[model samples]
Target: MADIERHDYDVIVIGAGGAGLRAAIEARSRGLRTAVVCKSLFGKAHTVMAEGGIAASMGNVNSRDNWQVHYRDTMRGGKFLNNWRMAELHAKEAPQRVWELETYGALFDRTPEGKISQRNFGGHEYPRLAHVGDRTGLELIRTLQQKIVSLQQEDHAEHGDYEARLRVYPECTVTELLLDEGRIAGAFAYWRENGRFLRLEAPTVVLATGGIGKSFKVTSNSWEYTGDGHALALRAGANLIDMEFVQFHPTGMVYPPSVKGILVTESVRGDGGVLRDAEGRRFMFDYVPEVFKGSYADSEQEADGWYSDPDNNRRPPELLPRDEVARAINSEVKEGRGSPHGGVYLDVASRLPAEEIARRLPSMHHQFKELADVDITAESMEVGPTCHYVMGGVEVDPDTAASGVAGLFAAGEAAGGMHGSNRLGGNSLGDLLVFGKRAGAGAAEYVAGLGARPEVSQADVEAAEQRALRPFEESGSAAAQHPYALHGELQQVMNELVGIIRRGEEMSSALDELAELKDRAGHMAVFEGNRQFNPAWHLTLDVANMLLVSECVARAALRRTESRGGHTRDDHPGMDATWRRRQLVCEHRDGAVTVTERTHPPMRRDLLELFDITELRKYFTADELGEVTAEL
Candidate 1:
C-alpha cells in the first residue's frame, strides 16, 4: 500500500461539470457531507465550452410554446425512441431549472419587453432556448460556481469551520468504484498533478462525467471526456444503454489543422447562417427527411423569407436537427461539392447583417478570425461534422436518476434514456440542470434510508494502488508500448472504421481491430519516471476507458442494423421496423463486453395523447398504437 490517503463523505460526486455542481448543490441542501471530484479545475469542466444556450419552453418569444410541444419535438427529434417519462420530466422541469439559475444570478440576454430572451435552435418547434448571446454556458457555470461558494459560506457559518460540509477534489481521475459486495461503497482515484492515490469512502456516488467524444480523431470534447464515467459504471456492473448513437455536430472548423475539431456553435444557424456548397448552392434544401418535411423550407426564396416572418414561412433547412445536417454535409463532401478545405461553406455573410452576426455570435466570429484568419462578416467559413456528444451512457430510472445498482446515481451526459437515439440542440444543458438536481435529491433520499456507512476493503485499495503503478514498472520492458501511439491508434481506428457512416463489414472489422488495441493498451507504458502533470501516463489510463467505450459503440452499431436518429447503417439503409422497438444495452460480462436488447419502455397514456395520431404512425406500429390507446 503506497500510503494512499483516505477520506469519508456522505456522497461522492464524480465529475464537476454542470451536472456535478447542480447535484452537489442539491445534496448539500439535504444536509449531506458531499465531495466533488473532477479531472480539471472546477468551473473549466466541459460545460463552459457550451456556446449556444439552454432549452426551456418559457414561451417568452412565442406564447404557443409549452412543455407539451417541447416534449413532442424532443420525441420527434429522437425518432420516438426516447424514454417518454424522462422526456416529459425534462421538458416539464427545464423551464423552472432555467428560472432557478436566474435566482442564482445567471443573467440572460433580455428582450425588448425585459424578459429573458429566447432563441431558435435546431429541432425546437419555437424560439425556446434561454440564452446569453452565444455564451449561455459561461453564465451557467459562473452562476453555479457562485452558488456553490454561497452554500459553502452558509455551511461554514453553521459549523464554525474553515472548510465547508462540501469538498472539491480538482485534477483527479477516478480509476475504480469500490463496491461493498454489490453496491457502491466508495471510489479509488488519483491526482493528476502528482499521481498520488486517494480513497473516497461514501455510501452514495453520483456519476456526472460528460461523454465519449475524445475517442474519435476529430472531436469537440476535451481530454477529460474519454468515457470515464461510462467505463467506470460498466466495470461496476451498470448497464450502458444506446451506446451506438454518437452525435456529430455539422459545423466544425475544417481548416487550420491545429484547431480542426473545434465546435462551431449551432447558434450560427439559429441566428440565420446558411450552408452553401462549392457552387454557391444551398444544399440542405435537398436533404430534409420526411419526418421534418413541412417544418423546413423547400426553396431558397422560402428559406430567406422565413427569417423575417415567423408564423407563415417554414424554418430554413440550415436549422434542421444535427443528424440531418451532419449527414448532408458528409454526402455533399463525398460528392465533391465540398469547399477548398474539404467541408461545406457556412455563410452568415449571405444571411445576417455583419453587425447582427458580430453582436449575436461574437465567439464564432472571434474563433474564425483568430484561428483561420477568415473574417466571418466578409466570407463563408469552411465547416464539417465533428464528433460532439454521445447519447448513450448509464441507464437510470426516470424519476430518481438511479442506475440499476443501488447507491449509484447518474445524470447529465453520463446518464442515458432522456435523449433516446439522438439529442436535439440545447437539450444537453437542460439535461445537466434538470437531472443533475434530481440525482442529488435522489441520492440524498437514498442515503437517509441506508442502514449504515459502507466500508472499503483494504485488499481492493491495495490492488487499485498496484494497478496505478504498473505503467511505471513496465516502462523499461522491451515490449513496452507507447501510450501516445496506442491512444492515436485507438482514435484512428474509431474515426476511420466506426465513424459517422457505418456498415456491417466495417463494424465487424473494427471489433477485431479494437480487440488487438485493447491487448496493446493492457501493456501500455509511459516515459521514464515523471509523475507530475505527466500527460503520457494519464493517457495510459484514459486509453483503457476509450477502448472499452469504443468496443461498446462498435458492437452496438453492428447489432442495430437500421438508420434512426444519430445511428445510420450504410448497408441496412433506413430505419427497420423491428429495430424500432428495441434499445441496445451493453454490459461487462464475465471477462468481456456483452450486448443485449430490451423492448423500449412505453409512454404513459396522457403523454401519448399529446401527439397527433397521424404523426404517431411514423414510429409505432398499428398494434403498438392500439396497446397505447387501450391503456387510456
Candidate 2:
C-alpha cells in the first residue's frame, strides 16, 4: 500500500449523493481534512434524479402539522417496523435541515404567506414536503454542489491550494475497503476515466451510497446503483438489515418501450391527478387495509374535495402509501382492468389546467412529451410499478450513524433501519439530510478520539490489486464472457423472480440462479485490454456487487414467509404475528451468506406513548402488547 500511489486524508466520504455531499460539508466544517469520492460526477448522484420533494414538518400548508404527526405518519408508513428513535430525529430535525439548505442558496416554491411551500404525499396526514415544484432533488443537489464550491473557494483564500482540506474525486469507484485489525483504515478505488487504481488512507470512512435498484430490470435508478456500498459494508464486517424490503414505486412510465420504468414523480397525484382503471374507475379504495382505516376517502367526490379542503375530508385513496397503491395497480392489471399498456391510467389532465400542469411538473411534462409522445396535460398517462429504492442497507446507530465496525459510518440510503419495511414518499431526501450530517459529524468526533491511525499492510493492497486486474487477464482469451451480457442476465433474474410480488418457489429458484451467476461473474472479462474508460471493465466490478446484493435480497425474501410492506409473499398474503417482530440480517462469512433473525428492541417509553392502544394491538403479540401497555 505504501509503495503504490497513495494519499492521506482524515476522513474519506464515499458516494457523493445528497448524503455524501452533506456529510462532506459537515466534516469540512469541523476542520477535518475530507475527500468526497463518488462513482459518477459530483452532481450526478441519484439524489439529483430524485423527482419528488423533501419531507419535513414545515407546517407552512397545515399549521397543525408538527414533528409528532410526521413521526406517527412515518411509523405507520413503515407498518411500525421502523426504528422509533430514527423516525423521531428525522421528523424533528428535517425542518431545520431544509431551512439550512435554503441558507446555502436553495430556493423553494413559496406559499401565499411567503413561507417554504408544502405538498401532500402518501401516508402523510398533512402536507409535509418542502419542495421546489417537482424538481426539488435537482435543486437540492445544485445547492449542495454550490456549497462545496464555496467551501473550496474559502479554503483557497485562507490557504494556498484547494486540496488542503476538502477535495472531490469524481469518476472514481471504490472497489475494496482496506482494514487494519478488522477496522476501517481506508478504501481502494479506481479512476473510472483512466482505469488506474488508487488508495486513500483515512482513519474514518462514511458510506453514503444509495440503493440496489438497478439489480432489477425495471428500475428508476441509474447504472451506478449496483449496491456497491451495501456489499462494501458487508465485506467490511458490518451487518445489513431488512435486505428483502425493496421498494417498487407505484407510478413508473408504463408506455413506450424506450421510456419504460422511468419514474413519474408523485407530485402529479399531489397536484390532483387520479389513478383509474381502463373503465375510468378510481380503484384504490378497494385495496385499503384495516390498519389504515379512517385515514383515506371512501368516495370519489370526497377524495376530490379533500384536495381543496383537507381538514374537512380524508385524503384520497389514490394517495395511499406506495405499497398499497403498487399492490392495487398490480391487482387492477391482473383483474383485466389495466390500461392499453398493462398499466393503470393517471389523469392529471382532467384535474388541472394545461398551464398548471406544465408549471408544477415541468420535468414530467417534457419527459412524457419527448420520450412517450403523450401530452400529460391533455390525456391520462399509463403507469405501473418499477423498482425504485431499497429500504434495507447497512445497519447503523440512530444518533451517531455508526456501523458496528469501528471508524466505519453509514448514512442516507446506504444505512438501514430508518424506513423499516417500507418508505413513505419524499422520506428519502429527508433521511439523507438528517443522517448525512450526523454520520459526518460522527466521523469527525471519532477521528478526534482515536489515539493513533490504523496501519495498512502491503499484503492487503497486493491482494486487492490482483483481483482488480483479473479483467485484463481474461479479456483476450476465447473463453472470455462479456460483462454486459452477465449484467443483463442479473437484472432479468431480479425483475422476473424476486420482483414486486414474491413466492417461495420463485425466490428459491432465484437464489440458485444467483449462486451460478456469482461463479460466472468471477470469470467475466472486458472486450478491450486497455484500461482507459473501459465500460466492460467497470461492469466486471459492478456485476459482482450486484450479484452479491441479489443473493442477499433473494435469500432474505425467501426467509420472510409473511407478507409485509415490501417483502410480500403470495403464499403468505397476510402479515403474520411471528415474523412481524423480527428482521433478517445478512452477513458474508466464509464466502457464503449467513442470515440470522434479530428481534426489535422495545421503543423508549416516551416514543411508545405516541401510539394508541388500537395501533399497538395491530403490530404486537398479546404478551408484547401487555408490556407496551404496562409501559404506558
Candidate 3:
C-alpha cells in the first residue's frame, strides 16, 4: 500500500465556497474540530463569481416585503415546484443570515437611513437583495474568510496553534468518499500541487461543492464545478432529485468566442436594462406566458415607468424569472432577429447614465471592457442563454440537510429540492448561508450522539488510490484516449441535445451518446507526466465525474416528459399539472444510472395558505387542491 497522510476531524467540509465556510464556522462555534477542503485556493472558490446580491426579505427598500411575500414569490418563480418547507425556511431565515454577515464584519452598501441597501433582481417581487454593489459575491467570500481568520485567532490564543480547532486545506480535491457500513467514514483526496494522497477520517461529511455547470460546453461555471459532490453522493449510495431541471441563465457573453459563456449579471436588467432584438424591439414582452401575463407590463411606457414608480406599474417582462428570459432569447435568435453574434441585445447604457451604470454595476462594466472589449455603459451587449446552474442535486432532508445515507449531508447548490424547477437570482448566496449553518449544526449534533466513530479501512483507501492512478496506468496503452477530447465530446453532447430546450428524442440520443462517452472515459489517459501541478491529469479525473453526472441528467431528462421551469421539453410544450406533483429521482446501481419517478409530499397547509386558490389552480391538480382546501 502507498504511504498516505491522515488527519482526523469531527467534521470534514468538501469545498471552500460560501456554504463550506459557513458550515465550518458553525461547527467550530459549536466546539467541534472541523476541516475545510477545496480544489481552489482559500477565498478563490466560485462563490466569488456571484455578481448578484444575496436575497433576503429585509424590507430595507420596500416596507411591504417580508418572509411570507418572499416565500410566495419563491414558489411562483419555481412555478410551484419548489419544496415548500425549504422555501419557507429560506424565506424566513435569509434575513437573519444577511444580518449575521454584518456581525462578521461584512460591509454592505447602505441606504440613506444607514440600513443595508437592497436591490432588484429577476423573479423577486421587491428590492429584496442585500448587496455590496455588483460584486456582492466577492464581498460575501471576503467576509466569510475574515470570520474564519478570527476563529483561527481565537483558537491560537487558547491552544497556541492557529489550526487547533479549525483548518483549511486548499488545492486539495476529494476523489472518493469512503464509507463504512453505508455510513460516511472519510474522504480520499490528493493535493493538486504535489499529487500526494491524503485521508481525513470523519464520522460526518458536509458536501457544499456547488453545481454541475461545467458538464456543458457553454457555461458560466468555473473549472471546479465538475459535479464533484453530486457524483460523490450518488456513488456513496445517495439519491439525486430533479436531475433533469437545469437552469440556463438568460444573459452570457455571445461575442468573442473565447469568452462566449461568461456570465452577464442580471443586475444589468435589475438596474433598468432591457432586452432588444436586432430590429430594436423589446422582444420579452411578446414571450410572457399566460401564467405570468398580468405580472409584467404590456407596454413600453409602463415598463419604463416601473424604474421610478414600481408601486404603480408592473415590472418589465425582462425582469421575469431566468427561465422565461432565456427561452425568450432563444426564440428571438431562432427567429433571425438576433444580434451579429447569434444573440439578442441587452441594453443598459440607453436606460441609465454612464456614471450610474459604472457605480451600480462596476464588475459587469469591467468584465465587459476587459474580456469582450465592449463598453457596456455605451452600447448594448450581445447576450444569450448559457448553462448557469443545475436545480437538481443530492436529495436531502429539508430541516437537517442530511441525505438518506447516515452521516452524509449536503447544502448549497449541491443539494436538491430547495429550488424545485428554477432558482431566483440572488437566492443562491442566501441558500448557502442558511443551509450551511443547518448542515454544520446537524453534523455536530449527529457526531455528539454517535455511539462509535466510523473508521476508514485500509482496503478502501488502497482502492481509492488505484482508482486515482488508472489514467497513469493507461497512458502507454494503444487503446488509450485523450481526456481533453473525451471531455470536449461530452460537453458538446450535453450542450447540443439536453440543453435549455429539450425533446424526448434528443434526450434519448443524449443518453446514448453519454453511454458511449462513459465507455470512452474508462479508457481516457493523460500524457506521461508527473501528476504534480498537471492540469491534464486533474481533468482526467474530472471527466469521469462529469460523464457520470451527465448520464444522470440525460436519463432523468428523458424520463420527464413535460415542460416546466428548467426542464423544457419542446415535444410537450405545456407544463403538466399532474407532473408538477412528481419528481424525477436519479440513483446509481449496477454500474449504470437509473431514474425513477416519485410524488412530492404535499405542501404544509400553513404554507399553502400563503397563495390564493386561483394561483394554486394553475399548478396543482383538482385532487391536490381539494386536499389542501380540506386541510386548511
Model 2 bad stretches (over 4 Å): 1-3, 476-479, 630-632
The 0-to-1 C-alpha lDDT of every candidate, in the order given, reads 0.90, 0.90, 0.92
Looking at model 3, residue 555 earns an lDDT score of: 88
Task: Provide C-alpha RMSD values for all models, in order.
Answer: 1.4, 1.3, 1.1
Task: Give the per-residue lDDT digits (tens) of candidate 1, residues 1-632.
Answer: 56788899988999998999999999998999999999999888999889999999999988899999999889888988888889999999999999999999999999999999999899888998999988888889999989988888887798875346888899999999999988889999999999888999998999999999989999998888999999999999999999999999999989988899999999989988899999998889899998777888898888878767768438889888899999999999999999988899998887778898899998888988998898999899899999999999999998999999889999999999899888999999999999999999999999999997778999988888888778888888888899888888889989988999999999999999999988877788876667788888898889999999999999999999899888888998787656777999999988599999999967777888997776777778777888664544
Please give the range of 10 consecutive residues that has the lowest summed lDDT in model 3: 623-632
Better of 1 and 3 by TM-score: 3
Tens-place lDDT per residue, model 2, 1-632, is 22456889989999998999999999999999999999998899889878779999988998899999999899888987888889999999999999999999999999988999999888888999888878899999999999999999999999978778999999999999999998889999889998788889998999998988889999988888999999999998999999999999999998898889999999898889989999998888898899887878888888888888957548898788899899999999999999999899999999999999999999999999999999999999999999999999999999999999999999988888999889999999999999999999999999999997997777898899899988888877777788888889889999999999999999989988988888877778877658789888888998888988889999999999888888788988998877767989999987888889999987777877888877788887887767667656
| Clash tally for model 1 | 0
Ranking by lDDT: 3, 1, 2
Q: Give the TM-score of candidate 3.
A: 0.99
Worst 10 residues of 1 by lDDT: 623-632
Model 3 misplaced regions, further than 4 Å: 627-632
What TM-score against the true fold does each predicted structure earn? 0.98, 0.98, 0.99
lDDT score for residue 570 of model 1: 90
